[model samples]
Target: MAPQPKHKNIVQILTPVVLFSFFSSSLAEIFFEERFEDGWQSRWVSSDWKRNEGKAGSFKHTAVKWPGDPDDKGDDCFRHFAISAKIPEFSNKNRTLVLQYSIRLEQDIECGGDYIKLLSGFVNQKKFGGDTPYSLMLGPDICGSQTKKLHVILSYQGQNYPIKKDLQCETDKLTHFYTFILRPDATYSVLIDGRERDSGSMYTDWEILPSCKIKAVDAKKPADWDDREYIEDPNEVKPEGYDSIQREILDPKAKELDNWDEEEDGIWRPPKVPNPAYKGPWKRKKIKNPNYKGKWKIPWIDNPEFEDDPDLYVLKPIKYVGIEIWQVKGGSIYDNILLCDDPAYAKQVVDEVFANREPEKEAFEEAEKVRKAKEEEDAQRAREEGEKRRRERDYDRRHRDRDCYRDRYKRHRRGYSDDDYHVS
Candidate 1:
C-alpha cells in the first residue's frame, strides 16, 4: 500500500482524543519509558539461561498481573527466553526515532521470535545472548511456511540493514501495538495497534540508504544492442510440402471392417486420411523491429556510495533497549516501552499503555478458559484417583483368594496339613 504520509504537523487527533496533547513533538523528548514497573528487576538484565542449554530461557517478571498467572498464561512455558535492557541516551543526532512497544502473543504463535530489540554498545548487558550486537531490530518474526515478515533490522555504520519492507505481521493472539518512526527526513513509519501499516524512505526504505542512483559503472550494452523486439517476416515464406504431414492422423470415418475378406482381410484399407490442407509445421509472420533500440538503458550514475543522506535517519547514540527474543510458544507480554523523539510521544505511549490491552486480552481469554478447565479437571481427578486405586487392589485380591482356598480345604481334611500355610 505504500502511501501513508500523515506526518504533516507531526500529529493532531482531537475530537476528545487528547493523545499526546496536540500530538507532542515540540522537539519531542522522553528518551525512555519502560513500564515493567516494579523496579524492573533492578533495571532489566537476565541471561544465565538454563533449561536444556543452547538458547534457553529465564528472564522473568510480571505484575501486569492475574490471569492463570505464568505471566498471564497461554503458551505455558516462557519458551526459551532471552531478555535485555539498558536504556538511557537514545540519540537521533537532530531528532526523530520513536520506538514504541506493547506486545502480547500468549499462544497461537507457532515457531517464534516475537521481535523487540533496539540496543547500542556498552555491550555486555549481562552478556546479552542471541548473538549480541544490535542497534535497531523491530519485532514479529514467526516461522513455518517461510516466516511472516515485519522485522526491520537497521544498524548502519557497523552494518545491519534489513527492512526493505515486506512488513505484514500480527498473527492472532491479541494485544499488538508496534510503532517505529525514525525520520530525520530520511523517513519511515510502521504502526499497528495504533494504525499506519507502512510508510517509506530511509532513502527508499533502507539498505542503509546508499543508491542515490547507481547502475552505470559503465553499464555497457552496445554490441550493436538490438534487443530483438521482433522480426521474422521478410515476406513470409513456407508453403511447399510443410513437413510431409504426419502427426497421428488415421481415423477417417473408418467403417471397412465388415465381413472383410479381400485376400484374407489384408487389402480392405480406408483409414489414413488427414490431408485437409495440412498446415502442420510452417511459421513466418513477426515484423516490428525497426532496429529496436528501446531496451538498453545504462544511464543513471552518481552513486559513488551515495552522499546526500540528510542524516540517513540518524542513529548511533542510542544507549539501550532490549528484549531480544526467540520464543517458540512462550506467552509474550512486553509492555509500554517508549523510547522517544516523539511521533507524538510514541502516540502518547500507545494511549497510556494500550489502554489495558482489551481488558488485558479479556483477562487472557478468561484465563485461557480457566486454564483449559482446570487442566481438564485436574486430569479428571487423576483419572478418578487412579481408578480408585485400581478398584481397591482388585477387591483385595479377590478376598485374599477366598481365604487361601478355605485354608487348603481345612488342611486336606486334617490329613496332617503341611507347613501351616507357610507364614514365616
Candidate 2:
C-alpha cells in the first residue's frame, strides 16, 4: 500500500462535484429563445389578416433609443402587427414551464399590450391574430389609468381564465424582464425584473375548477332569526320639541331697506336662513340588541358537482410563440425571449443579458433631461422674439398716427378743405 498524492486526492474530491454540475445542467431544457438579432425576419411570420384593411403594423428590427446591450438590437414594434414563430413542440407535464422576456416601452406607451402567447396544436403562423387559440398568455398590459397590470392567463378545458389577483406591472420607460413559472404541483409564480412579484396555487388563483365546497341549497336562515346586531333603543324617547324644530328661520340680523315701498312691491319679508340650532331629521340611538344573533349564513357542504383533477397543471403541447397586439403609439422594444423549465436558468439569463437596466435608465434620464432643457430654451426664445415683434409693430403704428396728425394740422394751416386732406 502506498499513500496517494495530494493532487490526486483533490481530483477525486472535485470529480463528483463536476459530474453533478454537468448532469444538473442537463435537466434544464430550453424549448425556444429569441434574441431578435439579425435574421429574425426569417424566423417570424407576420399575419396578413389586417393588411387589406391597413390596420396591421409592421415590426422593425431595431434597438431602443438607449441601448442596454452593447449590440443595441431588439424587435421594434412601431405599429399594430401580428407576428409568430414556430417552436419545438413540448408539453409541460410533470415539469416546470418558464416563460421569460424583456420589454422596453421607450415611447411611454399610453395604451397598448406587450403580452406574448404560447399557442398549442396546429397554427397558421401567417394568419395568427387575436383569434388564434393559445395555451398561455403572459406580459404587461397598460391602458390609461385604470388598467396597468401583468396578465397571466391559462387555458384549461378550452376556456381561458385570467388570474384572479390583480398584479401591477412595470410601467416605466425603462427595460423590464417579465417571467412566469408554472410547476407540476399546480403552483405558479410571476416575476418582474427577476424578482418574485406574486406566487400562489393555481387552484386558489384561478377559477379553473368547481369549488370543493359550496353553500347548501336547502340550508336557509329561519324566519325568526334575528341577525341584526344593533337595534333602536325602545326605551329611549325623542326630545319633546324635536319634531317641531324648523329647518329654516327668519334672519335676526335682516333689516328692512329705507327705500322699500310696501305699495309698489309686496310687503317686505325677512329672508329665511338655515337655523344653526336646528338639527336634521332625528335618528334613534342604536343599542346592542338583547335577542341579537350573529349573521345567519347558509351552511357549506361538500359540493357534489366538484371533481378533482390531478393533471390540472398540465398544459397542451405548445408549438408556437405569437405576439398579436394593437398599439396606438408604438415604440416598444422587445428582446431576450426565453422559454425553458429551469427558473434558475431564466434568472441567470436576466442577470447576464438584461443586467444593464441601471445603465439603460441612466441613459434615458439623461436624454430626457436634455430634451426638456431644449424645449424650455426654445420656448424662452419664442417669447423673446414675440415681445420684440410686438414692440416694433406698436412703434410703427404710433409713428404713423403722429405723421398723419401733423399732415392734418399743416393742411388746416394751409386752409385746404377737410375732404382734400385724407390723412394718407
Q: Which prediction has the highest lDDT against the true structure?
A: 2
Residues 181-262, model 1: lDDT tens digits? 8777777788987788988887767766667887776578879889889988888777666777676577778878678998
Candidate 2 versus the native: TM-score? 0.70
Candidates in order: C-alpha RMSD to true structure: 20.8, 15.3
**Backbone clash count, each prediction separately:** 1, 1
Per-residue lDDT tens digits for candidate 2, residues 293-387, read 89988899988988989999999999999876766664566667789999988888777654566776778888899989999999999999999
In candidate 1, list every pair of residues with a backbone clash: 115-139
Regions of model 1 farther than 4 Å from truth? 1-91, 94-98, 105-115, 119-129, 135-323, 326-329, 333-340, 347-349, 356-358, 361-365, 383-387, 392-396, 403-407, 410-424
The true-structure Cα RMSD of candidate 2 reads 15.3
Specify the highest-TM-score model's number.
Answer: 2
User: Local error of candidate 1 at 274, Å?
Assistant: 99
Alpha carbon lDDT of residue 328, candidate 1?
52
